[model samples]
Target: MLTDLPIRKIIHIDMDAFYASVEQMDNPDLKGKPIAVGGGGKRGVISAASYEARKFGVKSAMSGNLAAKLCPDLIFVKTNFDRYIEISKKIRKIFFDYTDLVEPLSLDEAYLDVTKNKKGNPSASKIAEEIRARILNEIGLTASAGISINKFIAKVASDYNKPNGQKTVNPEEVIAFLEQLDIRKFYGVGKVTAEKMYQKGIFTGLDLKQKSIDYLDKHFGKSGHYYYHVVRGIHNSEVKPNRIRKSLAAERTFSENLSSEVFMLEKLEQIANEVSRRLNKSKVAGKTVTLKIKYSDFTLQTRSKTLPYFISDRNILLETAKDLLFQETLNNSVRLLGISISNLNIELSKKSEQKSVSVQLKFEF
Candidate 1:
């Protein structure tokens, strides 16, 4: 029997080529150029490539040498994580003005539940449009948005319209939309999985839905249940506001690999600033500070220190990060540097505590 479910409203917002876009927004010289933000060494990887760079087959995670080969004229830029986090905070604040039910996936993307929004607007589509416009107006960066009845469809819909576009999928249109979508576009299906599905003759949602639960389970394991419902447009995930944060981190791959301590320290300071900003924004304090370094051989190493007290201060974080970096000996030229805050505290107010107690007593009576 088909269960009647209450209509939900979800929005997914994704920033296009986030790091590259931020660099372009800050420097007019970089605008309209094929830009790649990453290490330019033999083993260095591309962190983020601009849309122009993508046109030439450059992509994130691609080896820096291959990226340069793909687009010889590609301009590489050092990542400025501090600037990106600042912009992310402004964007998050814009989302909070509409609904508190915001779940950040990364610095560039998030899911928002606006089923019962502060705006009192009946249409989620209108709210998404307004949010996109506000982001452009306030942050000077373009963002694409998707509005739908659930997270699955909303995330897919957001990508339908590229760079500064909005797309919406109403509940009624869900099935037809999924029917035509490529198997690769499905959320959990990566390149390897899609290739496997193709070998099994499962090319579309209909093909996937036609397979028996037993058959799917035999192939995909426990995630088969998720695939079964997703193909049928039966997602029931909720927008949880009180999400526990597992990790907070900021990392940057340089435009050029460096062996110099002076140059590395400059970049480390910026990463530390970003990590601090993110911790402050989430109202989290971390007891551990970790430093990650990736060498030109693609080898990675990490050093971490747990502090006596939880901290979110920029200077303290930077100093700790600097110390960790100094302790490590650079075997090969360093390509990437990262700082992460591990332990977190979800802050609640003492004043709100008394109010909550009073409300509970009133309800009891």
Candidate 2:
């Protein structure tokens, strides 16, 4: 089916050891050193480990103690969520400059559909090269990119060249590439499935292609249809953007209950700033700004204001939030301060005005 339709241009971009790379970028001494971004204490899980650490058998999702055993000199650092979020925003902005259709798998990986790009460049490989260069120059980090005719191939291509590299898979070469690929390399075919496939003599794409759709369906259920087409270099998935805000929330549990307006305003500023950042990152502007307060007596109250236009500006958001906080009477010591922005506007385009005019006979009047 992919061969029957016009070829599309898709790209997958993944940062190299995202959190560990960020740590290295911030500290020059950590370069070429085995580093992990996570707590080194007991009961800590590794968030990310540098390539150097990987050579010693350290990996993300592994327990920190296990990583330490693998790499005796592994350096573990505390996670800085704010800093990581900031860098993620910058990387996402670069993707948007090239194409509006970007699907972020996480903070470090994304799928971009460049079939109709903002740059109007027909060559997807060239666009990927430019994007990779821009990210390295601006973010002080390296990323790997894959360019292909569809999402499945593009995702596979990105991993082909890891740690600051790029790879392209043209439509014509897709079949040859798939034929030689090991079954384990296929998306959704993990270790368990790979073992099962191996037992069935389905070790490669060619082996998978030989199997009937019904046979695969009997084994894999709905995903069998996906395997049936992908082995033949066919994939129809589209890049989807983050169009809605799943939750709009901001909260601060203070160390001490405070009745002072000054202290409460300061806390509200921080909450509003966080909400604004999240709204902007998701490309959503909110019409309602909600203020929440929890008193020392365990009583909770909330007030919300809906504005004429959606807003994401920090100053306007904070100012409105502070005003709402002051409007409510402080009956007890406040133990918490919160703000949330909701009712997202996904579309960026302005609405066009519709006008109607009628002219009467002035002479008759």
Deviating ranges (above 4 Å) for candidate 1? 1-3, 247-365
Query: Model 2: per-residue lDDT, tens digit, 12-123?
Result: 9999999999999999899999998984666567889999999998988787889999899999988988889999999999999999899998899999989889998878
What TM-score would each prediction reach against the true structure? 0.72, 0.67
What's the lDDT for residue 307 in model 1? 94
lDDT of 1: 0.85
Which lDDT value does model 2 have at 286?
80
Write down the lDDT of every candidate, Cα atoms only. 0.85, 0.84
lDDT of 2: 0.84
Candidate 2, residue 146: how far the Cα is off, in Å? 0.7
Model 1 over residues 84-203: C-alpha lDDT tens digits? Answer: 999999999999999999999889999999988999987888998899889888888999988877788899889898988988877667788888888988988999989999999999
